[model samples]
Target chain A: MAHLLEVKNLRTYFHTEAGLVKAVDGVSFHLDEREIIGVVGESGCGKSVSQLSMLQLIPTPPGEIVSGEVLFEEANLLDYRQNSPQLRAIRGGKIGFIFQEPMTSLNPVLTVTRQITEVLELHLKMEKHAAQSRALELLKLVGIPDAARRMNDYPHQFSGGMRQRVMIAMALSCNPKVLIADEPTTAVDVTIQAQLLEVMKEMVERFRSSLVIVTHNLGLVARYVQRIYVMYAGRVVESGTVKEIFGDRRHPYTIGLLKSVPRLDQTKSERLVPIEGLPPNQMNMPPNCAFLPRCPYRIARCEREAWPILRPAGGKHFVACHVDVDVKERARETARS
Target chain B: MQYYYWLGGICRGNLGRSLVYKEDVSALIGKRLPVTVHLGLVSLFISVSLGITAGIVSAVTRGSFLDQLITLLANVGVAIPTFWLGIMGIYFFGLKLGWLPIWGYTSPFQNFWLSTRQLVMPAVCLAVVPLAMMTRQSRSSMLEVIRQDYIRTARSKGLKERAVIMRHALKNALILIITLIGLQVASLFSGSVLVETVFNIPGVGRLLVNAVFSKDFVVVQACVLVVAALVAVVNLATDIAYGWLDPRMRQG
Candidate 1:
């Protein structure tokens, strides 16, 4: 069966004064219906840009989707012009986007009701009264207490978590087929993160809409997502079923990310092991392997070969690297020493 | 005391008689108020509309040819004195082209076309600085607002580009625009003094100027009082509008 959404060889560039920035370079991924996936990366890894490109939402002139095919529901979204009627209808109507900064994402002068009802009115062709009633219901679904009264209030009246809940409500207002939450919990307090994630999962399941959580936090993705794609230097270096990725992770970048995250399962006090090298600059990226400078297990051939494509290392697990480090041999050598 | 005597007359709704016009100060003001008000309103309408449109265009199509043109015009607008522009306007539009009257006022009620023709040069002169200031103020303000996160959110909702600009960006940018407009009202009337004299129009500014020259204390004080009152009313309206536009301002 065909996938619900598939991205083929996406490349988004920013023509800055300094030079061109290949923000999302030759990245490809897929999402099945009702599935939850996470796109993990550090800042500037192009996780957010890739999703924005899918909707053609990036600011033009400075940002340009150089080349890409965004296949959704058997239609190539990129084939539609940025301001075309079809793309406009599909964006907020069929697919909802939840941005990172909920605090500022909402129009401050407008009431929460207006923000939510606007989407419904534009896409669903609902009357003002009808859209408002639906907005109240969506607010309650997203776990906003006193949804009725808060609907009339401005964004500033609410706390950070409450505002985020409103954002979730707005995104799921139309019962979208796919919901993209771009770092939805980063701005909130840590205690609210778990609660917010749970509420998000429940809402996604309730709407029967597939969720794509774009975040840099590995731990958040590990707990919430069914599959995870580790992006490095604007490329998906590793992807697999959650278990395969965390258990038999082949990419050095992925391993570095996992180690950097402070896990709760630690019994003894251990220092956090952060990845040593700085991320590669987009303007001056090395032609061969972008990760060559940072890869601890890089072989002599890694510098000579061009960046490798995703090759199956195991069932449902793929790794993009020229050489594979022997896991058993490393463990044996460590033990003997 | 002169103060108490003058205050007592005001309490009785009597502004005393105009020594020069030899009419009740109230009656003199009533006759002349309409012309001044008409000029003010028309000039304000032209300035605000052109200024805001230019600003929105400048901000939206930033660094474009049209934006550059507006910026250049706005810069020139601030530099040219209203009196100098009026003289130049009279030379070109009045004396040279005979397109409009160089001086005097006609009630629109009497002859609409003649009144419009008579009002053009003076109105344009009065509107210049405000239009210039308004353009600069709103351009920067709109530039800031359109870059805001909420504007992005509005676009993400798939609004047509124009709808996003008008509905989302415009309202947010309006508060600063309103404040600038309020500040401009004082300048508008103050500048009108020069414009009315240059055009020889029978406006309140001309009445007050003539009174000051002839040493008519009663008319001078009343004109100042009326202008101050108008400014006060405009400021009050702006504050109320500010509170209404932003709910955050309304709360304690």
Candidate 2:
């Protein structure tokens, strides 16, 4: 099947005062039609940067796409002149983005209707009356009550969840083919987060758009995404079907992540297994495997040489570590017990 | 409070007569008011238009050669004493160049071109302070507004760069610019004294300066009260404009 989006050997680097920080170092992934892909990593692991690079949203001068191709519908987006008017037509019209902070994402002073109608007017060339009606429709579709009255209200008037719904409404107003949601639920409460996730899932399914959900919450994306890409130190350490990742995790980092989450099934006496040591600084990343220093199952070969390439273990399950997959599992189970 | 009430009554045209001029203070103001208004309004128009345009350009192309040059010029304009700048203008544009009349105002009914020519030098000189002040204020305000998240949102919406700056950024910066307009009015009324004296323009500034020197208490008092009233009114207008510029102010 032809992929809807494909990123090949993506490398986004930031030239900082200390050194060149490899924000998204040599990452690659693909999505098919109606596929929901989850990119999971801790903060600063380049999950956000990788998605930003796809949209060419990284601020240039300090940050740049060093070398890569972000292929959307068989076309390399990275090669397009970002400032060109033609490229902008594709941004909101073909692809939509949902930022982490809903408050900061929506323009504060503008009415929700104006914000939504901007996309309709710009890309669809809809008239004011038509665009406004469409905007109200989108607001209703996102489950905002009294959508007509609320259209003229500012972002601050909405609750956190409502504002997030407004964001979702704005994102889906153009019926984009791809929606890139970066930490959409991190700011809201758990209930609101769940509601937002449900709304997003419903919207994605209804629109039949491929969704790329980037978040550090392993549990949040487990049910939402079909394929999961686990990243560490700006690299995709492991990527496979959600079942392969959660059911039979291979990468030591992936296993460590699973052990770290406090499961609801756990007893009151159970202690969460937090990953030891901080993530490696991208500027000072080790020459060999980045996770080797933090890995409990680190071998002599892990320190002496570069880590093994991402290879399929079975049925499209890919892992990066050279250590035996069974050994990593045993270590996780022992730590949990 | 009684004195303020008295002042308010005088402002409402209750004041009787000017001791020095031996004329009704209300009548004196009515006659002289139009001259001052013409000078103030024209100079304000020139200053605000030129200053805001220059400021926007300077801010949008920050750190560019034009920005640096405009900043340098504004600094010099602010530092130069208005009196000295007026005298220098008179020397070059009036006496030396012989392009304009050295002093006086002509009735526009008599000769419209010549009357405008006589008014030009002093008006230009009186405008300098406001121009300098407005340029600095507008540049700083535009800089702050440009950094706002709405500006980025506007850009991301696929609006052209000019639309982002003008509609998004500049509109938000207007409250500060309007506040500066009030300040400029106060400074311009005071600063015009030197220019009016040098040019012999029949305006309130010249009247107030001559009255002070002559110790014409009634005329001086009348002038002071009028200026104070002007400042108060301008400030009130500016306060009202705050609501128009920012909706948050209206809520408060």
Candidate 3:
């Protein structure tokens, strides 16, 4: 079967007074039907930009999707002429989006029912009574207790977790085929994050919709997502199943990322490894490996050669580095010790 | 002793006798208040509606040629003095085109059509600055609101551009717009002084200006106090509106 969504060579650039900032440069990925995928990266690593580019939601003045094809349900969204009606029909109708900071994502002035029913009325063509009932059901579905009473309340009246749930309910109102959640739990506490993740898992499974979780939290992705894509300097540095990524990670940056996070399985005394140097300045990104400066395993060849491109490294795992697989594994093993 | 007597009279709603009109202060205000109120309401209504619409358009189409054009016009409109605009309006519409009555007051209750016709030029003249201010404020407010994450969520929900702007963007921008309009009430009344004088209307603005020139302290004092009260009332209304409009404010 065809993939649920396919993004190819997506390059989203921001034109500023200084120069063109390649926010999402030459990145590519695909999502399977009902599959949960996580795009993991630090802030400004183009993780959010990459997902937003799929829906063409980036603000245009300084930002533009320069080149790419975003294929949803076999339709190319990147086509210039497909802007208004076609894209609008596909956007919330087929693919829903939940942004970071639910405090700011839900309209503060609008009642929860109004916000949810707007999507139902617009896309589902539900009447007022039916829409209101459906909105109440959505609120309940996302685990908002006493959903009927809460419908009349505005966003500001809800707690942060509750607001995030409301946002999720709004996203799921039209029964979208895919839901792109951008750092959905970053604004909430860890306990709330666990609950939200569980709610998301259950809801996505029940809805039978593919979920694309965009976040910097490696631990969260490791525990939740079936497949993962590690992004760096606007490119997919590594892509693999969760097991392959966690067990046999090849890319140095991915290794650094995994090492930086504290694992419960690890001994209490293991010091968290921090990646040295900052992510490269996007405006003047070097032609060679963008992560060369911060890469612990980077060799002279890495600096001499152009940035390595992703190549399948057997069994659903892909790595974008010049180093030999055996040598990289040996280095990783030594670092682990 | 004299001040206490004067204050006691004011407290009882007796604003004292008008020196120029030689009428009861209360009666003078009662008769003149309606004209200013009439002019103020019509001009405020027009300026707010038109200015807000222009501002929304300016913000939604920001950086477009149309946005730039509206912004430029708004700036120029704000800079143009009301008295000068009023004279130019009189020359072009009243004298040259024979379109309107250049100087006079007509009550809507007396003759609705003629009152509307008489009001058109003066109201437009009075509206220019506030309209410009409203447009500028709403534009910036709308631009700020549109940048908000909720607006993106609204658009991502497949809402039409109109729905995204009206339901999401405009509603958020309204609090700022309301505050601006509230602040403008003072200027609107003071602005009418020049506007009424240029048009020779019998509003309180004209009454106040005439009273000032004639050194009628009673009339001047009454008008100033009334204008201040109007400003205070408008501010209270704006605060109430903010509470009504924003739940976050309501909670606090």
Best by TM-score: 3
Better of 1 and 2 by DockQ: 1
Clashing pairs in 2: none
Model 2 residue runs over 4 Å out of place are A16-19, A279-295, A300-303, A306-309, A322-326, B1-12, B15-19, B98-120
Is candidate 2 or 3 superior in TM-score? 3
lDDT of 2 by residue, A1-337 (tens): 6678889999999999999999998999988889899999999999999987887777675798999998886678887876677667767788888888887777766788988898899889999999999999999999999998879988878888999999888888888899889899999998898899889999989998889999999987798899999999888999999999998888889988988887899998878888899888889777799998788888788989885779887896888888886775676669967
Candidate 2: residue B166 lDDT (0-100): 73
Report how far off residue B93 is in candidate 3 (Å): 2.1
Judged by whole-model lDDT over C-alpha atoms, candidate 1 comes out at 0.90
Q: How much is the lDDT of residue B200 in candidate 1?
A: 96
TM-score of predicted structure 3: 0.97
Scored against the true structure, residue B41 in model 2 reaches a CA lDDT of 77
> By descending lDDT, how would the candidates be arranged?
3, 1, 2
lDDT of 3 at A316: 83
Interface RMSD of each: 0.9, 2.2, 1.0
Candidate 2: RMSD to truth: 3.3
Pairs in clash, predicted candidate 1: none
Tens digit of per-residue lDDT, candidate 3, span A1-337: 7888999999999999999899999999999998999999999999999998888898886898889888876678888442488888877889999989999999989998999999999898999999999999989999998888879998888999999999899898889999999999999998999899888888999999999999999898677799999999999999999999988888988888988988889988779989899978899888999998887777889989999999998888998999765576686679978
Supply the TM-score for candidate 1: 0.92
Provide TM-scores for the models: 0.92, 0.88, 0.97
Runs in model 3 deviating more than 4 A are: A80-83, A325-337
> Which pairs clash (backbone N, Cα, C closer than 3 Å) in model 3?
none
Q: After superposition, how far is residue A244 of candidate 2 from its true place, in Å?
A: 2.5
